[model samples]
Target: MKKLYSNTLMQLIIALCTFSFVACQEYSIDSQPEGPLNIQIDAQDSYTALATSPSNVVFNISSNTPWTIESDAQWCVPTPSMSASSSLVSEIVVTMENNTGKQSRTAKLTIKAEGISNTKVVTITQASKEDLVVIPYDELVATEGEDITFTIASNKPWEIIPSTAFISNIDKKSGTGNEDAFEETITIKVPANAGARREGTITVKTEFMTYTFTITQNGVVIEQEEDPESTTISVGGTSTGGTVKIRANKEWKVEVPKEYQSWLKAEALSDTELKITTTVNNQLSTRVGHIILKTKEVVDGFEGITFDINQSPAFWFNGSSENRVIDEATGDVKIMAVAGNNVIANYAIKKGHLTFELADINLNGESCLHFNLWPNAGNANIKLWLRSNSDCDFRCAGGFGWGQKMFSLTTEELNAIRTIEFFVEDDPDNIGKLRVRLSINGEEIGNLVNQTNIYETDPSNNPGQVINLQFEGGLNYTEGDYYTVKSITYEPAE
Candidate 1:
């Protein structure tokens, strides 16, 4: 029985040992690195590709397992391209491409061994590439110094973190299109400062891209200085007139005529070559305004003129041959010219008197009277008479006759209230000497003067009103030889 038991135990033990060995072999086979294909690979962390050079990719394949790399995987270009080496552990090189004017990108790579695979893609960017990114104006044409508002319309699709930039404090806003342009503003000051030129740029970026713009500043340039001072002038004096020299700025416009305009000449040495000067040579009844000097768009030449007032002649004798006439301080008028402000004065006081022996004296109604005066301190004594022809008769018309009427001569001041009269009427029966009374308030001033032959032009026919003195000189003669004037002299009344 013991021997039989020993034989069975041995058989069991052997069978158990064989079973343990098979189990051990099966566990080892199950723990082994198993796959469709398994081979150790030398793939780096982010293999696949880089910006420029090829990224080496090694794939581990199982023994006798077939595998290949995708054709579209390149490391140096934008589009992916690839090439693979032997089985067991296939290796591939990838070249990536540069995208926009932005970053560089590499295609995702996958290694397949017997239908199972894994993939990894990488993108590399270029060195912040940027060109003349035009900064567009909102309005092509605009006014100076207006506000400009905008932002960077970037190139990429995704919203990007703006790149570092510099400009005249531009408020960045929303971008434009897919290839959106950067936004900014430039203000132009006008006239004086605006139209001047200025310069600058625009910049933008994402995780990958950067850009910039060529900046320039531009606007209109205006003037404001035209206020001028007014010219003042005084009457009874002189004034310099013409284009008032506008030292500060702006534009202007002068005429003086005859009267006191004697020797109407401006001094040659005067600095006011563009100005005009005139003098008042005589007196006038009305107030004369300023002496205006007319201006023109261009120069014509010198304009010279003069005027006359009532019969107060304005005589200028600078080079004249008169010894007694003296020049006034005003440098224009002459004193003691011809006895009556106009001629050569007769100073000797001659004794010879003129007598009129008229024939016939007729007036065509015009009474031209002549007078002799005695002036003493603004007071004057006067005698007047009708002038007649040489031959005493009753017919010719060549004479200044004033015998028909009578009037008074009185000064408003000194000679006022003095009554002087000569009473002598035409005699109907005589042709010889006629007696006339020349008296001043019951006193005889002188001999009652008479004329030879002179006719009277009715006072109603005369145009000029004469200041005649009723006080006659000597006695009135008869109508025969007509009343004759013995003399016209400056002798005092006796």
Candidate 2:
């Protein structure tokens, strides 16, 4: 009985040991350690940047898990707050705003990763506003042999470097900056330039940054002599005028006749030139005038130089008369009734088509046709047609206060006397083609037609074909809804 009890006790001890080992193995399988929480940051502990301008700080992060970033200051912001786990290194950017504060400031940035107990810290410091340099002007314009003064403010030492030889005698080449916003006055002398305008640059260097500015200098003027006999100036009937060369060494005075003084004017443009001007000469005959130029000294065997100015006459259809009879057969222009029973009258209101043939006028070159008309009441619809030698016809038809392809007029302008002009010339782009334009009251409106093939079909046969201008009143014209043609004029091509 004693041997059997000893064997039973040994078996019970072995079964208890086996059960404890199996329970330990099951606990180890259920609660295994998590993957390694490895993370690294590649950046410095501190950084410095400018205060006046925005600056950026870049760094790299390496991690097996996701990461995030945060900033303590409102001015300092990080681009990405959270990032996924990446095998390759990821870049992070921290942008700092411009610091307008009087003193320098600092910000703290924290970088953290998932499942990590500790975070990386970075400190960023920005300079103060007083630490930056300031330039008031970026460019300077100086005359020949002139001095230019400018100011520079900074709290550091600065230097100026001129890029060209013309810049000389700088008052201050170097200055020590001050903390009280001291402005340093810099004066530079520009030497005389006898030939042409010159340009150069002045580079300013400070402890914080570098800046560049431009310097422009004017050229000198030289005296010249011009012969007055060979210098002849002519102007159109209605033009501002032209210039004439004069001797620069003499003091000159111009004398205009009493009759021509109201229309002619003369002034000195420069020491070597004189500008002559004239008002509009609305007469039919060309006018001639002599401008007597009296100088301080005698020149070319005469006490006073005489310059003859000839102004071309303005073309008129009825010899400058507002009310004139229109001959149906012979004259500079022939008038004929075409559409309605209304006849052409002297300053008369008409409601029919009137064809005016430009007798013996050629349009192969540049020319202008001008006329005055009054739209009696605003209910008249007028059509003006221009035919060049029966080849092509250009038409402009519109009521008053409306826009047309040729021109546009206001209601007030149509009720009063308004001048209408048509200009015909060769097309600049298309060779052998013609271009026509329209104008109202001396202001050019727009082109009527361009690249028009005129006089091309029978150029040899129609060598001197006349231009036909026709006016047609609206078919719905009433008693008072009629337009009147006051005057007609033509300027032949020169």
Candidate 3:
């Protein structure tokens, strides 16, 4: 019976030990802590006003657990007395007593939260009484020879100092402070600037701080002679030049258009005169160019002066008596052709003559005749000739046989308004022989036609020779062919 009792007690002991171990294991696995402690603040540093006028800085706090706030300085007090724990977010207002001492003062605020090993700290700083002053403007612009006004607000005494002699006539240079910020009007007069623009500064000095106001004044104005003689000048066709005058207080420059720069040129003779020059006007049409004169400085009233230059044409004839020969008896000026829809000749009908009686001009040297002709559909036959007089026969004339040998034009050239030019000059190589060159639309074509002894020297072959430019068409070809002469001109040798 004794052995049975002892074995029963040992079995009971082992079962109790096993049950206690299992219960301990279950409790350790199910009851585990989560996450870490966190705290955040909106500001790490804050600023306050001077001691006489105290300012409040509000701090926003966020914490996962409950938190408390405390300040290290006696002069800085945090409101809502965070002696107890507050969860989530809390806004605490901190009132700071301004530092009356010479140096600025700072205080540290400590925020503590439960279960967090580290704490958050914010530093608050307060400005001293001597560091406070409010000036209205930092920089100002004053007109030439004018006065400028501005106000300065401060609670302390201040005195003004000008950097240069240009700044003068100050209304109030020094003033005493008051309990509240008092505004004082400051008026400064700037003398007129005769040279370049000037800049200076006005320094405001107090017991401890210094402030500055910059002043800028404009320079003198540019003046020019408003009522001059004239702005238009004329030049002759043989490259003769002219000049115009311009008087200004400042230096001036001329700007010419790019297209006319090749032929036109301008030079400044002095502070008042400008000379205009040009190359020879070879074409039969008048040419005009414009130029601008500008001063370096700002003008009082004028922006720029514009000048016009007119160049005369070398020789111009458009079915008018200006350069043509009119019949004395009938007073009739021969008409060659018209422009656009005015048809000069139609091959389907009878033959037509496009003739021009040029004035008795000496063509012994170099001469050129230019005209625009339009042949419809490229189906036409035309002939051009130049004689000294009407009595001269076709065989004795010096001209081109259009649509024939050495002067054949392409279909594209025939369909458009073609610019035909005839050049007659004494051959350089052969003195007596005349060199006749032809071109279409500024492009030279056909070999240079050389005619020897065809001028006044040979009277039998060429009679009544006076250099008359004429054209006769409609000798041969298709029925629907037609042509028109838009314009014609003669440029005699210079």
- On lDDT, the candidate that comes out on top is 2
Q: TM-scores, in order shown? A: 0.25, 0.33, 0.31
Model 1 TM-score? Answer: 0.25
* Model 1 clash tally, residue pairs: 65
In terms of lDDT, the poorest run of 10 residues in model 1 is 390-399
Off by more than 4 A, model 2: 1-41, 50-74, 77-95, 102-104, 108-121, 127-147, 154-165, 168-181, 192-494
What candidate 1 gets wrong by more than 4 Å, as runs, is 1-37, 42-66, 72-91, 97-106, 114-133, 138-144, 149-153, 156-167, 173-494
Q: How accurate is candidate 1 locally (lDDT)?
A: 0.31
TM-score of 2: 0.33
Q: How displaced is residue 318 in candidate 1, in Å? A: 57
Question: Model 3 over residues 1-494: C-alpha lDDT tens digits?
Answer: 99999999999999977865674364332111234666666765656556556768886765557777788889898886563453335678888775766455778888877778787778877754674454534453433477777777666678889898888678888887554556778888777665544678888888767888677775532223454446666787556466665665468877787878977998777877777888755433456787777766665544566777777644334343333333534333333322221212111111111222322222111111223232232222223432221211111123222222234333433434246555556666766655555554566553343445333364444322222223333322232233323323444442
Tens-digit lDDT string for candidate 2 (368-423): 22232323333223334322222222243222223245433333433342455665
Superposed on all Cα atoms, the candidates' RMSDs to the truth, in angstroms, are 33.0, 20.2, 18.1
Model 3 residue runs over 4 Å out of place are: 1-230, 281-286, 296-303, 318-383, 386-417, 423-434, 441-494
Error of 1 at 128 (Å): 13
Which sequence of candidate numbers ranks them by TM-score, best first?
2, 3, 1
- Least accurate 10 contiguous residues by lDDT in model 2: 361-370
Displacement of residue 1 (Cα, Å) in model 1 is 54
